[model samples]
Target: MRQTFHTSGPVLMGDQTNSQEFHLSLEQITQAPADCTLRYLDFHGTQAKLGVEYSGTAPFTRDGIKLSPAPEQAAPLQASWCVTLLSPSASLAQLQQLMRFFDGQQWTLVAADTLAQRPECTVIRFQIEGDLNFDRARLSCLRVADQLGADLVIQAAATQRVPALAGFDMDSTLIDAEVIDELAKITGIGDQVTAITQATMAGDMDFCESFKRRMALLKGFSEKRLAEIAQELPLKEGAYELLTALRALGCKTALLSGGFTYFAEFLRRERLPLDFTYANELKFAEGALTGEVVEPIIDGDRKRKLLTEIAEKLNISLERVVAMGDGANDIPMLNLGELGIAIHPKPKVRMQAPQAINLFGLDAALYLFGLNDRQIEKLG
Candidate 1:
């Protein structure tokens, strides 16, 4: 997966001897080198009154604004690390402990930069110079983040790139609710259908079989009711902001779902500003659901295929495609994209995907694109 580092936090160092309390201007902090892995600079007189913590090899920021070096002072690019804290209360001590654990390992952690700053979630970039065992480091990061109730994303310097196309899983990833489950509710079989959905999405049962069973329970439901559900589809937090921002960046967006085209089409035409959408078609007869999906189900494999097709059509490399999902069915496309991000995913999805977002709104994905506080603020 394409990896980018976006970080911001107070470098809380318990070691006072090496920790120098010094004041620096925003420009000075911006011009700071990326080679220092753990440097804590107290920001004085800044509007936000926030301290500057640099842990990765990228520009530092407070909130979404970058603390950059002056025009003539930009440093040469080096290794990059992106660390995102999904939990608001994750202490620097936890990170310090992680690095200390790594201290005995092969890789050496160096300087860092802040990317996006929020109270609940923060992203930081770090520079590493060593013959490191990346796989081991990744495992350690996952373990630590899980224990600390946070998320950690690591991208080697070479893999970082801005994506040209992004494919999003619709039902749970983009919208807050599952359309099928909602339809089941209307059919008075909500509990049964919801259980099947959970199992299917958790990879316990075949999605096709589970879907067929669920749809059968919804047989004879009015198409008008489906339309009503579509009208009330609640988008996940930051869905609109992320899509709009992506469109502005000339990034083509596609909604790839195993869910019905009814709601996906509604989102494209009436709500979200997506450029393309591919989903399973629901069969209807005389303005009523026939309790069947069209042939050639848009399952996980199909989702991956569609992602590749969309990337090819846009003339974008798979290395510049970002895929987001929240279910077991999304595993294929999640692995297919250059950056596979699981948003509030199931336990199975969380363990497999390289990156995940659990603590913040969907907009935080923007940080993965290397945007800073200033750029994000301007998006408003």
Candidate 2:
């Protein structure tokens, strides 16, 4: 029987001196025919075989037909995406509809693995065959999440899916409340502070300027009260679980925030296993608020730079880094990391981030890394 082999480029088969040219006719392969196995005798007198079961072009055909082993053209590099459903009642119908959309775009699913099987929250990982518009995928996931009362997280498939260093925003991300807003409430300047915060998070005002205005209002505030409030900062849902799991996996964590250093230090010391903490230091004199932060405040730009520095110190590429945040100032670092997650972020952040978790707790972030309940339990 006549057969054909589709090679990407010139390749030396077996020993260089023993290599021989054996060219065959090329046939156009449209759809993968059926379950087939290609067996051949190796130069070393051993049996070599290849299995083809998926609906993709075969690289080599035994029936004088041109075939490819991949979905389409020979791709030396392929991008993968992990689609996780974080709602117990996620609709299969919606998922299938999205899959159909993907198929229409000529994207192929190489494999589908179930990460979580809970009825309330089902997580699935799909290894795709090609590149995709990740931003659009995030939006689609958001729509599905809204429809099914679910939360969706989409991540790029990577050689190192788990980051060695994880950077998180302190307010409304690692913790359930914004420290500044809480302080404002205590000082009876809640309304004014809240307005500034909304503007700052909405990208209407520069974060540093807004911070200065807010801090100015808290002038003469007692340092002891700040410490007391810092100790009472409520942790975000799944914050402890997420950090513990990451620590168990040998990953270093950083609390990078635009919030005050006092609260960030508190979380690092008592709540989470943080290796690094960077935030605005509240300048205090005579045990009272000085109404000014230390020079060169940690703003959005600083946050981005810190992530890069942390990656360099750990000798990891930017792609091996994960950053999470929930405000306008967080856009920089979020975009800098390989996996930038906006957790319950503002409207602008929601639209810009490539991955986000809206419905579930901070623990849902674990699903983006393809971790299921069983795996997480083992870590604990």
* CA lDDT of each prediction against the hidden true structure: 0.69, 0.68
Error of 2 at 121 (Å): 1.6
lDDT of 2 by residue, 312-374 (tens): 998978877889999999999889877888988898998888787776677777767656567
Poorest 10 consecutive residues by lDDT, candidate 1: 68-77
User: In angstroms, how far off is 322's CA in candidate 2?
Assistant: 0.5
Candidate topping TM-score: 1
Q: How close is candidate 2 to the true structure, as a TM-score?
A: 0.76
lDDT of 1 by residue, 1-380 (tens): 11223332433456322222234443444344432223222221342122334433333332323433312211123655544444444344444554554455545445444554444454555455666565566667778777755567665554455579999999988899999998888778899999999999999999888878887888898988887888899999889988988888888999999898989999999999999999988888999888876888888989999999988877888888889999999999988867888888998887788777766667778766766556766766
Q: How far does residue 117 in candidate 2 sit from its true spot (Å)?
A: 1.7
Off by over 4 Å in 2: 1-79
Query: Residue 288 of candidate 2: its Cα lDDT?
Result: 91
